[model samples]
Target: MTVRPPQNLSSLSPNAAVDVLAAEIRMEKAISLERTGEAAAKAVAILNALPLDDPERPRLLAETAEAVWGYFIQRELMGQSSHGAVIRDLAIPREVLVRLGVRRMP
Candidate 1:
């Protein structure tokens, strides 16, 4: 199923509108990744395109970071490179991690 943003975003609160847009963008990127095996670049591009002032930005960043981290862990369990270059390349910001309650390693 395809996901699309609300047509009347202006009718919604700013936070709600941003949340809806972020969800749609994430869904599209995930579908693209499943079809093309190119997620890191697309994910980063989508995240970077969001306005810095959008309230949903941090939530989107945290969710994307967790998804990428899980993907890397799964790949490592399958004997792929444990040190995922893509994960490193994404380099989720420490602030986002903290917001998500993910502790940084020493």
Candidate 2:
């Protein structure tokens, strides 16, 4: 197989290349945050709807915790470290909050 030369960015000035790359990065970040938020929401909804006595309730709680944790980490990566507003806005259950980072006891 013939090695192909790198795609040309010489047509773009340094600033222009930087700006284009930045825009792409921003779009990627927005998409990531949106997807994470959606997953967290879905997990929370399933957990909330599960009956407390249901055997699946614990599993749902764990799933919700993982989703919420992922969302939080994504926000933190975006430099939004304050979670009080997010926690309040999402109405995350205290049970799930407590389970964040906790492993199930075998």
Q: In TM-score terms, which candidate is top?
A: 2
Candidate 1 off by > 4 Å:
1-42, 88-106
> For model 2, how big is the CA root-mean-square deviation?
3.9
Relative to the true structure, how large is the alpha-carbon lDDT of every model?
0.59, 0.84
Instruction: List TM-scores for all candidates, in order.
Output: 0.42, 0.84
- Residue 50, model 1: lDDT of 87
Which digits, one per residue and each the tens of the lDDT, describe model 1 over residues 1-106?
Answer: 9654467886788789889888987777566545333453455557767898999886677665655555555445445664446546656455443443353454
User: Candidate 2, clashing residue pairs?
Assistant: none
Candidate 2 accuracy as lDDT: 0.84
Worst 10 residues of 1 by lDDT: 95-104
Put down candidate 2 lDDT per residue, 76-97, tens digits, no spaces: 8998888888777777899999
